[model samples]
Target: MASIKQREDGVWRARYRDEVGKEHARHFALRRDAQRWLDEVAAAVVTGQYVDPKAGRITWDEWTREWMERQSWAMGTHEAAAVAVQSVPWREGQISSVKSSHVQAWVAGESKRGLAASTIKTRLNYIQMSFRAAVADRVIATNPALGVKAPRSRRAEAAMRILTAEEVREALDAADEFRGFVEVCVFAGLRLGEAAGLQLRDVNFLGRSITVARQVQGSTIKAARIVAPKYESERTVYVPDELMTSLAAHVTRAQVTAPDEQLFVTPLGRLWNRNNAAGEWRRVRKDARLPDEVTLHTLRHTFASNLIAQGCDVVTVQRALGHSTPSITLNVYSHLWPSAEDKTRSATASFMGEIRDSADSVRTETEKPQVRGSRYR
Candidate 1:
């Protein structure tokens, strides 16, 4: 049975019971609309397909945070995910009221705010994932975010900046004062934090290698901390001869006060932070007259690029850089692989030469003078 009410303003409200015995209500300016809604609800209830309107009232923002809190993400990954989730426009709102248009608007607004294409796409992905979880929980009948296209992240191709050999040399020369950190990053491909957190025990001078086991982090000098290396994988990278010489010299000059002390420390004997290293790299790059875009990570890219250009295989480079997979190394440095056109041309030329030689042999046999004198006559 359905109940109807008419307010003094003449608007009508209708209430009905669904097949599942759940109550639903709707208001309309016209009695016909209210009656129509009741009919639709009754038919849906008969078909066992009625959905409560209250389910669609949750806001997108509320569900996203709930999803994030319940997820177990990596150390830095959780922070990144939180930022992306917060970047959504309706981040604080209920998930049920969010429509596809809101997502599109958020993406467009993020672009207008000068967010990088990659960042915008990442935020969109996080939102979509959140909505997916909502869909699974029956908070919404369907994910409104489905089929939404994210802007392609062009910054990846645009930001493929690599340092020139001259710039690398200039930066290395300028880093003579902080040779240990510079050599490890530029040659051994140690990330900034890994290099700063390295202890003397992590170095094997006899093996000509260093183990990346931990990372230095935190904001305050009093609260400086060491965290496990990214991905929890400790890798040993072989040192180049030149880098070995620089490391040995820097160690002797620094006269490290404690064997357990960090190999790269500030003048105050505290762990070196990324900001300080970046500032030093910038100063060196400027002193060497290199472009301002060159950064500490640029040294790592240079190392990988130089290695790939030297015919080092992708797997070897992957291990050298402490990458978890060779695919990562190949994806970044595959462009530097030798061109296949030259090999194809050489192969074609070799095949053509063989064909020509075979043709000459056939012609020589066909044109040979008759040797009938020794035949029985």
Candidate 2:
């Protein structure tokens, strides 16, 4: 059946039933638009190029459940993707009938809603990727979320606070029972989950390198759930000899002889989380008189800064911090690197010094020019 009608809300509605007996309908502000939409649907029905328009009407909650079931990905990535999608405007809306204008409006709306541009960018990526999948599944003709304009959020170049060697010593002293865990975080640049997930077999005492392959899953009170590292975070980071000795002692004291045994844990022997970091963080923050803004992640920034300050290359620091690329490391810590002007100045000065040395050699040869002249003559 085909019909067009004007409703009390001053809108035109068009309805059609496909050959499969599936009904599709849409509303428009004008009878012309309704007629046009119906004509397009009629043409599609005739040539058999039409997909079920009603398929796009599935609620986001329903589609998400189905889409999630189809995805086999790392837990961390799945969580990230889920968070990114749920943050969007259409999270609870029908997935069909979404348009490029809707996505653009969402980007602008998110910016006005106090979301950072970087966060908006991430959310936009998730939607675009999802719509792309919808296209492949014949759920939509095009990805409505692609090529949208979003706000650009560039972080300030201000450097993070780095503990001096003396401060590090005091912080370690304040850690007391949790000192071993703090040591690895500050020295090895592991994320909190990675630190919590540290196992006996991952530490290579002979090589002084720690292999990071997995991270602790979140919010479990029972058996520790291990998952692949975040964002291609698997890497081998070498520790200094001083930290190596501490790790050796830590292993010995923890009685970790088994490969799967966790090297660091709460006093109760359970894995650590933000809520259960114990008084170790509190005591260290208090006794050390550290800045209130400094959290465990600050130790990571400190480690990266220390590495760059000591002339470690960005790639090495990127691997150590488990960043997906060196560009990320550079983006976050580029200000700490030697300025291009400084490098140019140093290079020019070295070249001038070499030129002066050559000039001196020529001066001596000029005095001996008569000798060479005689010999060649």
- Clash tally, candidates in order: 9, 0
lDDT of 2 by residue, 1-377 (tens): 88999999999999988777777789999999999999987786576556676678886666766787789876656776788777766667888867789889878888888986777887778777788887677676667877786787665454367777887888898888788888888999988788888899999988999989878875544534677788789999999888889988988888889998988888788888644663468778899888776788778888998998898998888988999988998888998888999889999999999999999999998887453346655
- TM for every model, in the order presented, reads 0.75, 0.74
- lDDT for 167 in candidate 1 is 68
Give the Cα-based TM-score of candidate 2 against the true structure.
0.74
| Residue 120, candidate 1: alpha-carbon lDDT | 79
Instruction: Please provide, for model 1 over 81-100, each residue's C-alpha lDDT reduced to its tens digit, 9 standing for 90 to 100.
Output: 77887876675566777789
Pairs of residues at least 3 apart in sequence or in different chains that clash in candidate 2: none
Candidates in order have lDDT scores of 0.76, 0.81
* Clashing residue pairs in candidate 1 (N, C-alpha, C atoms within 3 angstroms): 58-94, 58-95, 58-96, 59-94, 59-95, 59-96, 60-94, 60-95, 61-91
RMSD in order of candidates: 7.1, 6.6
**Predicted model with the maximum TM-score:** 1
The regions of model 2 sitting more than 4 angstroms off are: 1-35, 42-51, 88-91, 97-117, 141-144, 149-151, 159-167, 220-224, 274-283, 352-377
